[model samples]
Target chain A: MSHVYERVALIGLGLIAGSMGLAMKAHGLAGEVVGTARSKDTRDVAVGLGLCDRVTETAAEAAKDADLVVLAVPVGAMGAIAAEIAPHLKPGATVTDVGSVKKHVVEAVSPHLPDTVHFVPGHPLAGTEHSGPHAGFATLFENRWCLLITDAGCEAGAVANLRALWEGMGANVEEMDADHHDLVLAVTSHTPHLIAYTMVGVADDLRRVTDSEVIKYSAAGFRDFTRIAASDPTMWRDVFLTNKEATLEILGRFTEELFALQRAIRTGDGEQLFDYFTRTRAIRRGIIEAGQDTEAPDFGRGTSRK
Target chain B: MSHVYERVALIGLGLIAGSMGLAMKAHGLAGEVVGTARSKDTRDVAVGLGLCDRVTETAAEAAKDADLVVLAVPVGAMGAIAAEIAPHLKPGATVTDVGSVKKHVVEAVSPHLPDTVHFVPGHPLAGTEHSGPHAGFATLFENRWCLLITDAGCEAGAVANLRALWEGMGANVEEMDADHHDLVLAVTSHTPHLIAYTMVGVADDLRRVTDSEVIKYSAAGFRDFTRIAASDPTMWRDVFLTNKEATLEILGRFTEELFALQRAIRTGDGEQLFDYFTRTRAIRRGIIEAGQDTEAPDFGRGTSRK
Candidate 1:
C-alpha cells in the first residue's frame, strides 16, 4: 500500500520470478515491471504471459532505469546475474534475490553491487514442486514466509521498504543472517528433499518396474514422499551444489538418528518406537494448529475437493 | 450385493471399521451389521455416530450370530480379541482382519478360528491420518485397493463374496498370499511410516532443544513428513513390531540407496543427482497418471481445492 519502488525489474522468468509478477499485479504495488530470461523462448513466453510491462532478453536490459531488481534464478546463477545487471542498474537501486540458499546468494551477489546500489539478499520461504511461467499465480506468496538475509549493512529504510513490499504480497517477512538461513533451510528443505529423492529412487530401481503397484498402494505412505521428490530437478540440483556443507552436516545428524531408530526396531524395542511415534505426533499437531496446514485426517481424503 | 453372508459383524470402532459400516450402509451390502469395541466409550460413540446398526460392549456378543466377522483392531490386540470372540462366532462364519500387516495378523488370529470357520486376512490399502469411529466417511474406499490374503484355501465362493462386499464399498480387491501382502506393505507402508516418525521426532527434538527455528520455518520441506508422522501411534507401533523383518528389509534397501545419493551429492556429481531427481519425477508422474493422486503441489496450496 505504501510507495516502495518506482520500477521493478525481475531478472529471471522461472517459477519465482513468474510468481513475483503475479503477486505484484495482485497488490498493484509496483510502478513498472520489466522481466528478462536468458533463453529466447522463456523471454517470449514471459511476454506472452504478460508477466511484465516490457520483456527483455537480458538482465542488463531489464534492470536499466529500474528502482528495484530481484534475482529469481538458481543459486548457482545469482552471481552472474548480479554481474550482468550491475552495469545497467540505476543508481541507488535496491537488489534482492529469491534463491532458496541465502548465504550463497548473499556472498555471490553482494560483492558485485555498486556502492550506490543496495544489495539485500532474500530467500522467499515459499515454492511448489511445479516450475515454469505457467506454474505461477498471484497468490503464491499469500501467508508464506519470506526470509531476508544480508550482512550488507544496507539502509534500515531500505530493509523496511522491502519488508513492506513483501507484506503487501501477504508474506510474513523475517530477517535472518544469511549463513543461519542456509543452515535452517538445509534441514527443513534440502534434507527432506534428499530423503524423498532417495526413497523414490530406490523404488525406481526395483526390477519389476512396479509403477502401477506403487501408485495404487501409495496411500500406504509412499505418496507423500513422491510429491516432494517430484520438485524441479534443476532447482534441486542447484540447491545441493551451492549449499553443500550445511546439507551434509544435517544429513550426518539425520543418519545417526536414523541408525538409532533402526537399532531400536531391530532389537524389538517397541516402547522406544511407541514413545518416539507419540512424541512426533505432537509436532504434527503443532504444525496444524499453527495454521500452516490442515488438521483433517489424511488431509480429509474423502472430503478434499480434488 | 449378493447374498454372500447372512450377517456380518465388525469388531472395532475406528476409521477402518467405521468406514466399513458406513459403506455397507451406503450400498445395503451387508445383511446385518453388529459392532463392538473393548471400551464402552467407543461403543457409545459408535452408536451415537451410527457407525453400526447395533453396538455391544464385547466382540463375542456382536459375533454370536454373524455369518462373517471382521477383526479391525491394533495388530497387537488382534490375538486377544480373536480369542475372546472365537467361541461365540456362528458355525461356518468367515473370519477376516483389516490390519496393515497380513502375515502376523493371520498367524495370530487364524489359528484360533474354529474348524468350521473360514479365515481370510485382508488390508484395505486406504486410510487417512485420522482415526476413531467419528472419522470414517462413506466414500473412504472409493478408488482404493484392498488386498485379501489366505493360505487356508478358503472356499472360492466365500472369497468372491468377500470381494463383492469390498466392491460394493468402491474398492478394487485382489487376493495374494499372506506373506506376499506382508512384504509388499512392509516396503510401501510400514517402513515409510517409521521413516516419517523418525524424521518428525528428529525435528521435534531439534525444535525443543536447539532450533526454535525447526518449526517456524517448517515448510522448506519438513512439514510433509509431519502428516505421515501424525498417524496413529499405537497402530504404527504395532505395525513395526509385528512386521519387523519386512520393515527392516525395506529400510536396509532404502538406506543403501540413500547413501549412494548422498555420496553423489558430496562429490558434486550434479549429473547423478539430476538424473536421480529426474527419474523420481517420472515415478511421481506415473503415480498421478495412474489416478492415485493429484499433480497439485502440496495438495494444491495456491488453489482453493486439493
Candidate 2:
C-alpha cells in the first residue's frame, strides 16, 4: 500500500486510534502519523510503543500540518477537540471521526470545523472487551465494516480518499446517511450492548446466588454477556446517551418481545418458546454465512482458549 | 487414569453425552461406555463417530449390567426414560443424570429407581451451541464446573466415585442442593439464553434493518447473542419448560432491571448506565480470574480462527 495521507493526526490515543496507528504502520497507509492524548501517561505510552511518528501534547499541535485528522475521542468530547484544532487544520484537510454514534458526532463537531476541511463521520464495527493503547493490534479492523456517513454537499474525492485509507488498513467501507447509521447501529450495536450490560447487572445483583457461583458457572451463556458488559464504560455510556432515541426504541421492542417470551415461560407454552428459539437459530446461520462470525462451536472460544 | 466404573451407560446421545463419551474414553475413566438415543440416525452417528463402544437400541438395553447409568436426555424426557430403564438397572449401581435442571430430574428419576440403586442428579456447566454426536470433543468439560446434587440418603461412596469420574475427565466438581442448583442456573444460564433468543428475534423482526445488514454488522455485539441463541431449540425449550419456576423468577428480575436501565436511557441518565456497566465489568474480571473465560481480545476468537 502507498500513502493516502501525507500526515495523519489522531486526536485520541485509545483502542481505536491506537489500532489505526499500528495498522497504518503495518500497511504503510500514511506517510507520517502524529497523535495526542489528554493524559501525559497515554501520550508517553503511545510514544514508547511507537504508535506514531510524533506524539504531541495538544490536538492543535498534532493537526497543524496534517492532511487527514481523525477525531477518535469519546463522542461527547468531539466538539471541544474539533474547536481546538479548527484553526490549525491545513487547507482542504479531511477531518473524520471514529465515534460509535454518527449523528451526535456530526452535530457536535461540524460547526467547529472550518469550511475548507471535509467532515466525514465514520464508525468501525470492530472492538473487543479490552480497551486502552496497549489493547490495540495491527489487524483489529481486518474484514470489519467501517460505516461512513456522508452529507449531501461533502466532497466525493475526500470521501474516496478516506475510504481508501481505511481499506488500506484492512476495513471494508460503506456509505450511509447519518440518521440511518445511528438507527441501524442502535439495532445492531447500541441496544445489544445496553441489554448485555443490564443482564450482567442483574446477575451481579442477585442475592440468592453468590458472586463466586455466578462466575464459576458462567461458561454456559452468561460469560458472553459479561464480555460485552466489560466494554469501556465511558464509551458505552456516551453511546446510550447520544443515541438515546434509537437505543430506547430498540429497547422498547426488546422489552415487548421479552415480555411475550416471559409470558410463554410462565404459561408453559413450549411451542412458543421452541418456535422463537428455532427462528433465532436461523439468524445465527445467516451471520455465519455472511462471515461476520465463525461457525466453530462455542463461538470458537472453548476450542482455542482451552 | 484407571477405570472408575466397570461399565457406563449414556442414555440420549447428544452433545453432552457424546462429549462425556469422548472425555471418558480419552482419560480411561470407564471400562466400557454404551449409549442410546431415541432416533436411529443419532445412534448411527454415535457409532460412526466412535463416541461409544456400543450403541444400544433401547434405554433398558443400555442400562442392563451397567455400573453407572447416565441419563443425558433433556429434562422433559428424563421421567419416561427413567421408567423404561429402572427395571434393568443393576443392583448397587449408581444412576446419575446430566440434565440442566436437577430438581425436576431428581423428582422424575429417583422414584423409578429401586432402593438398591444410588440416584445422584448432576448438571455439567459446559456445552457449545452445536449439538449432536458430531459436535462432541474430548476437552469440552476440561476446567468447567459440574454441579452434583446429593440428598441426605445418597451414599457418600457413590458421590465420591462420581466426582472422581468427572475429575478424571477434566472437570471441577461441586455439590449443591437441587433447588439451589436450579435457581443458580436460572440466573447464570436459563434466563441469559432466553434473553439472547429474544434479542435475536427482535433483530430479525425489525423492518427497518435488513437481515443482511444485521448479519454483516453483527461483529459489534449481536454476534455473541446470535451464537448463544443458536443453541439446540429442543434442549432450550425443555429447559424453559421444566425449569419454569426458577426461570420465570429470574426473568421477572431481569425485566425489572432492564426496565430500570431502559428508563435511565430514556431519561438521559448517563450516571446510572455508567455505574451499572462499571459494576458489571467487575463480574467479568471475576470470571476471567476464575479461569472460566479468557481475557484475550475478541473473546480469543480472532487470533485463533483467523
Candidate 3:
C-alpha cells in the first residue's frame, strides 16, 4: 500500500501502538512513525525494537510535524497527552485514538485539541492479554474489526484516510457513533472482561481449594477466564471506571440470568437448565459462522505455550 | 505399552467414551473395545468411525465377559447403566466412569455395582464444546488430568491398571476423594460453564444489541465464553443437577466476589478494581508455568477455524 500518512505520531509505546507502528511499516502505509511514552525505559525499549523510526521524550515532540497523531495511552491518560500535544500538532492533522472505551476517550481528548486538527476517535477491537512494546506483532489486527467513532465532525477525507490505514494493517474498519460504540463494547468486551476478572478472583479467594489446585486443573475451563483477567490492570481499571454505566447495566442483566440458572440448579429443574443451555449454543455457532473466532476445539490451543 | 485390559466395554458412545476408545486403540491399552449407546444413530457413527471394534445393542451385551467396563454416560444416567450391566459384568472385573461430578457419580453408580467388580469412579478434566461420537479425538486427553475416586473398596491392582490406561493415553492420573473432586471441579469447570451460558444468554436476550452485533464483535472477548457455553446441553444439565450443592456453593461465592467488584465499578473505585485485576494475573501466570495452558494470544487460535 502507498503512504496513507506522511508522518504518524504514536503517543504511547504500548501493545496497540507498537503493533500499529510495526503494521504500518510492514504495509508501507506511513512514511515515518515516531513514538513517545511516559516511562523513559519504555521509550528506550520501543526504540530498540524499532517500533518507530525514532523515539521522542514527550507527546508534544512526537506530534510536531505529524500528519496523523494516535492517542494510544490508557483512557485516563488521554486528556493529558492531548493537552500536551495540542500546540504541537501540525495544522489539519488527523488525530485518532485506540482506547477501548470510545465515548470516554472522545470526551477526554477532544476539548484539548485545536480546531485545526480533525479528531477521529478509533478503537481497534484487537488485543491480547500481553502488553507493552515487546508484546506486539505485525499481524495482531488480522481479520479483526476496528471501530471508528466519527461523530465529532471529522472531515470525510480524514476519516477515509484513517480507515485506509487500518485496512492496510489488516483490520476491517467500520464507522460507529461514540455512544453506540460504548454500549456495544459493554456487551461484547467490557462486561465480559469484568466477569472474567470476578470469576478468577473468586477462585483465588476460596480457602478450601488451594491456588495450586486451581492452576493445575484450570484446563477444565477456568483458564480461559484467566487469560483475559491477566490483562493490563491499569488499562482495564480505566475501562471499567470510564465505562461504568454500560458495564453495570450489563452486569445487572448477567446476575439476573445467573440467579435464574442458580435457582434451576438448586431446584433440579433439568428442563429449564437444558433449554437455557441449548439456546446459548446457537450463539457460539453464530460466532463461528461470522468468522469472528476459530471453530477449533479449545481455540486450537496446544498443551504448550507458544 | 501393553494392553491394560483384555476387553474394554464402553457403555456410551459420546465424546468422552469415543475419545477413550480412540485413545486406548492408539496406545494399545485395550485388546478389544466394545461400545453401546442409547441412540442407534450414535452407535452407527461410532462403528463407522471405528471408535470400537464393535458396538452392541445393549449395555449388558457389551459388558458381558468384559475385563473393564466404562460407564461413560451422563452423570444422571450412570446409575441406570450400572444396574443394567451389573448382572453381566465378569467376575473380578473393574468398572469405572468418566463423569464430571465424582461424589454424585459415586452415589449414583456405586449402589448398583456388584461386590465382585472393582469400582473406581474417574473424571477426565478434558473435553471440547462439540459432542457426540464424531467429536472424539485420540489426543483429547493428552497432557490433561484424570482424577480417580478410590474411596470405594477398589483393589490396588484395579486402580493401578486404570491409571496405566490413562497414562498410556497421554493423561496425568491423580487420585482425589469424591467430595473434594466435586468441589474442586465446581470452581474450575461447572461454575465457569454456567456463567458463560448466562452471559451468552444475556447477550442474546438484549434487544438493543442485535445478535449479529454480538457475534460480529465477539473477538473482543465474549467469544471465549461462547465456546464453553456451546458444550453438550444434556451433559451440562446432568452435571448441574447431580453436582447441585458444590456448584451452588461456588455460585454463591462467585456472586459475592462479583458483587464486590460490581460495587467497585459503581463507586468508581479504581484501586479496588486494579488490585483485584492485578491479583488475578498471578493465577494466569501460574497456569502457564504449570503447563496447563498455552501462552499464545487468544489461545493460539488462527483467524480461520481449523
Q: Which candidate is the best by DockQ?
A: 2
Q: What shift in Å separates residue B286 of candidate 2 from its native position after superposition?
A: 1.0
Question: Across residues A16-55, which tens digit of lDDT does each residue of candidate 2 receive?
Answer: 9999999999999899999999999999999888788889
Per-prediction DockQ scores? 0.62, 0.69, 0.65
Off by over 4 Å in 2: A207-211, A303-306, B207-211, B303-306
Error of 1 at A51 (Å): 1.4
Chain B TM-score for all candidates, comma-separated: 0.95, 0.96, 0.97
Backbone N/Cα/C clashes per model:
1, 0, 0
Off by over 4 Å in 3: A303-306, B303-306
Model 1, A1-306: lDDT tens per residue?
645677999988888888888788768889889998888888888888877778987889889998889998878889998888888888878898899887777778878888989888787778888898777777778888998874557688779888888988889998879788888888778988999888787666651644356666777788888888999998899999989998988788788888988898789888988888888888887787777777766755534321
Docking class of 3: medium
Instruction: Assign candidate 2 its CAPRI class.
Output: medium
Please write out the lDDT profile of model 3 over residues A99-141, one tens digit for every residue: 9998888888989989998999999999988999998888888
TM-score of 1: 0.96
lDDT of 2: 0.89
